[model samples]
Target: MVLVSAVRDYISRMLQDISGMKVLILDSHTVSIVSVAYSQSELLQKEVFLVELVDSISKSRESMSHLKAVYFLAPTSENIQYLRRHLVAPRFGEYHLFFSNILKDTQIHILADSDEHEVVQQLQEFYADFVASDPYHFTLNMPSNHIYMLPAVVDHSNLQRFSDRVVDGIAAVFLALKRRPVIRYQRTSDIAKRIAQETAVSTVVYSK
Candidate 1:
């Protein structure tokens, strides 16, 4: 239950410090990360009254200052844009931003710049990027499935992007466990080697 426990612990840490009724906001990717490990009843027990996607949350104009917003999303540009728009005209009284993986300094600056109202209570990287499907396995649910079959030289940028995501997911799992692992990959697959190397680099970056 390593992956499940890690995700559950991360969620618990995010919610436990913030008291009172809260609305849990998640992006499309994070929704899968959370749903597999946590249940509605469990969230209700933790005082989470609402669960909405970041994009969908902006559609509602009604204000609910009574509830705090707990956002768990990926550090993607689209997600950042949605947050910027939400921060411009916030409906909730307080916002607690938590990225599922490491966030860049520029992304932090974007969020800080957008929060003119001073509604953000905290910003943190929780590193639950993968969906913990079972005790022994997890998935990134990467969209570029076809890229894995193609040679790395065919489309270097897309291949790099794909490798980076795989690395991030691996890094997140290790970060959750608080351990540095010696990565190994199948020698037959170039993609696996690339992912492993990138994961090693990520591990080094996170270690520092």
Candidate 2:
């Protein structure tokens, strides 16, 4: 199946069982995830009254206890931190956390520890990580992506950020496919080699 369809299926399944007015919460990355596969009208059709960013959602003290919250986000530290803060005093009645890839157990524990209000109902990993820009080609859209051209010592921070996103996207795709295929990288690209190394490590960990 296509990347869009994979993400759409994950979302459709997330919202299918719950029958009521809902709010869809997304991180910066996940906004693109849902936006590509689903539309504002489609969310409205599913009784999703609001679609807000996780960071933005925390800005208001207004309690939306009437709407169930379905959070779809990348399994990033920032998103986890946001959930920790929100769980301290939840605005939504029920929260269902759907991550885009494998979540660290520590991340789950952190969220669980903060959920004193008992608002979160479920936690799961759904592998729909890559942005499906098109059928034939998909860009990882790694921020600081240009850093791949520099040596590790020259742009360590930016290169790390770039590789993390690329590895995340590739793993997401492979996880979605449930495949273990051999991969190749451009031999000349510095970033490509680094990303390939990271991807290898990720595959080894996830494959086990």
Model 1: worst 10 consecutive residues (lDDT sum): 144-153
List the pairs of residues colliding in candidate 2. Answer: none
- Candidate 2 global lDDT: 0.82
Residue pairs with colliding backbones in model 1 are none
lDDT of each: 0.90, 0.82
Candidate 2 TM-score to native: 0.90
Candidate 1 achieves a global lDDT of 0.90
TM-score for predicted model 1 compared with the true structure: 0.93
Show where candidate 1 strays beyond 4 Å.
143-146, 152-154
